[model samples]
Target chain A: METVMLDTGISERGDMQKSRVKVGIKKLDLFYSDFQALKDVNMDIEEKKVTALIGPSGCGKSTFLRCINRMNDLIPGCKVTGDILIDGTDIYKENIDVAYLRKEVGMVFQKPNPFELSVFDNIAYGPRTHGLRDKKKLEIIVERSLRHAALWDEVKDRLNKTAMGLSGGQQQRLCIARVLAVEPSIVLMDEPTSALDPISTGKIEDLIAALKNDYTIIIVTHNMQQAARVSDYTAFFLLGDMIEMGPTTRVFQLPGDKRTEDYITGRFG
Target chain B: MTANDRWSSKEMILQYRARQKRRQAIAYAFMYLAAAFAVATMLAIIGFIFTKGISEISWEFLTSDVHDAGREGGILPIIINTLYLVGLGLLFAAPLSVLAAIYMTEYSKQGILIKIIRYFTSNLAGIPSIIFGLFGFMFFAKILGWSWSLLSGSATIAIVILPTLIRTSEEAILTVPAGYKEGSLALGATKWQTMVKVVIPTASPGIINGIILGMGRIVGETAALVFTLGSGTDIASSLMSSARSLSLHLFILANEGISTSKAYATATVLIVIVLILNLIAGWFGKRINRYKDAR
Candidate 1:
């Protein structure tokens, strides 16, 4: 199988060598029973940068995002082939602990899914699951994570209250905080702002911009403008195929493929 | 044509509305009558039992041991035996049922074997209690040689309620939102950790409801206990010692024509215990809903 290297001149710019490949996918194929959801996809995600996967519904962009953390393993009769390497280590290989991999690759779902626990416990859940027991240590971690997700001030006083009582946006940020408590190196967001209002979405986009300085972030979005605003590199997928991927500016301003240009310029999805 | 001509006149619309209201009134009356009849029957039973037995209940009557085969003294020994039997039965059945339900719902694949297991579990619940009694007598009492003791009776009651417990528990577990499990799993929690931390806590109210229902069955159970548990009026000293449950005492008193009042009193006590369990289940259910609705 041919490995499609979509590398561009952007990687050759000054200080580019410092930005290493955080994830490398080669000839990846995914199927749910008979239906292929992702086909021969390949990309190298950079460290400490935001990579946005933008496509219309049923375009396999979300499928590709889930593939990064192997979340597709939960689905019945799902199959995967080829490799998904994080930091040059093949995550698909046998003996790789999925729990540990997920600890390194935390995910925030589209809908706000806070557990039926207090705000503090919700953020502390990941650390506790990983065997953090000291109360003071958990308190510190929870506060730091909530601060990182930009939800600290709103929920600081109500940390002992049930997380379900928080507003939709607060709940989403709390989920992000929960993931951050695990201290993952990579953060996967599956349309994190799709369910939020404009203001909440703006807050999340700002947080993403701030987050990329520390963690490798991969986000899937349907909004084209959002892709342009937050992502450093943009990958457009259609019908299980990655049609084009490059620097976000180049992909939006001067797309190489006609399909990419058509999709980005408001042609039929 | 004008819009006024196309629509019904005000008088005509009023007439149609009146006719619809009359029809709805008739339907509502019938539905209300059906509900009233169900409540009336339940109240009638409780009224009769309390009226007949309330005068018989007193400190002396409740505290004294059974004398002259349940005709002359309080049912203290029988009450103790009832508690012991039901408690022991629940201890044996509840954890096992919950574990089985979790395995069936969370771990097992939806396949032919699981389908068969579910089929048998549901069918087992519908089986007559008398059949269970016969099985208990044969298996626990005779074959196992734990004959006619509280141990045998409690074990029999456990089997009798196991199917009900497992079915309700499985249904409760199924009602947990899929997102909770997914969220937990995405956080690097293992499947078992997700189940323990997220799934079980969310489903606990439903599980408690199932257990309470099982407790009612065990408390009211008489036919099954009769064959496995001997009708001894004395308080049981050990697992091997023969004992009599409240339902069994009620059965013997009424059946043998020894004391109808005593039987009514025993029935009253059993009803009160079941009522308490039901109230607890309701409280837990409401608390869970309130927590959910807080959002």
Candidate 2:
């Protein structure tokens, strides 16, 4: 296996002996104009593990997921005052290039947003944007990423067809493949299966399980069963506050916070 | 608690239903009448023009040079001049208008300035073509000293179509799904890359439709060209050389009573060109719909 060196002169090693934390958030606060979207969020996400952020609507779980790749920067009047460190590097620092940071921290949106392009081109879009132009190299990346996304067999014969022709499930997987082609270390999924059918949602959950062996995965999900089934660690958020976070089993079985217990027991959001 | 008790009586309910049906029928009748009137007006104008002008059209009428102030010869020079002027105008206007729309939509903050710009752009579209001609005369012809030349005419036409292009392009850009842009950006593509790769391509069919519509405007324009483009009958030798467009030639032939037959022939050619442009625009409009359906 090859190691990827970040621009901060830190080589990311796959060794288990090193510090397990892949992302560190400290004193994080986010405001959209007058509304505070996230309040004092502090968490450490482990390397090569699945972390599920379970919350109700407008709970800021999706907002926090977007913060990982600085996707919130696209919103006007959005302000963030905090430290978000990925591999010991503060991503929001003045010297950090946002585009480069986003390349290393890919995101998957809730809806299936495949480009209105060929299935092959959809996978190749990220690699091409990152300046990979060699045809054979792109083909290899496309195939490997699709296989990793568990969509290669279904779409291999129609790679040249427009991705808009794919089923909703296939399109979502194609979106995942597109993110994988960039080879980001951390994958942020914002309710990726919320728009999918049950069967497709199951496939995505399975893919997420397989993916955590190679990438640090952070998922924002409204489905509690999904969170309990797929995540190694579960964080419960409500009304812009993270109420509880612990191992998935402990959080579900013996939650430390009353809110977490209430939320899990279907008492109230 | 029976359904009939809530309605008071079945007789009253039948009367109410009859009144509602009558109201719907009246509304649909009015709508149908308005639509029919609009289609009839368009067809009438086209039918009148074809009947009066189509007979005068010939291969020579489209291919030969003008003589005796368009009384005796073909309108080939005028046709070429029209194409040259409109093409140059589009070349100048398309990029400027598209860029302005992009800046307004993507880069500029949503505030009073954008509102004012949008206000003026839409207002500019409603202004009469004669006003544009007068402005073109003052700006491009007299002040710039490019008096009555093809260059002046092209520049004038560019302004004439700027609002149309800008508004349509802006609308097209807006119609692109936010998901497409977000998807691209999420994949680490910069805003510029997302716009170039996703938004612009998605919006292009609409933009092209706008251009075709603008071309139709330029093709039909006479007053705007009369002041900026000189009524020279000869083929334009360069950008600086004075020349007349097909519309100008038709106007001169009919207005001055030079030759009604020649005017009709020129009108026929101009109408044909506009019809072709409209067909192309319609095709592009369908393509835009198809793209929307695909997404």
Provide the TM-score for each candidate, comma-separated: 0.95, 0.94
Q: Clashing residue pairs, candidate 1?
A: none
Maximum-DockQ candidate: 1
* Model 2, runs deviating above 4 Å: A1-19, B1-6
lDDT (Cα, tens digit) per residue for candidate 2, span B175-248: 99999998899888999999899889889999999999999999899888999999988889999899998889
DockQ, candidate 2, comes to 0.67
DockQ of each: 0.72, 0.67
- Model 1: CA > 4 A from native: A1-15, B1-13, B291-295
Residue A124 lDDT in candidate 2:
98
Give the whole-model CA lDDT for all candidates, comma-separated: 0.90, 0.90
Candidate 2 achieves a global lDDT of 0.90
Correct interface contacts retained, every candidate: 0.82, 0.73
Which 10 consecutive positions of candidate 1 chain B have the poorest summed lDDT? B286-295
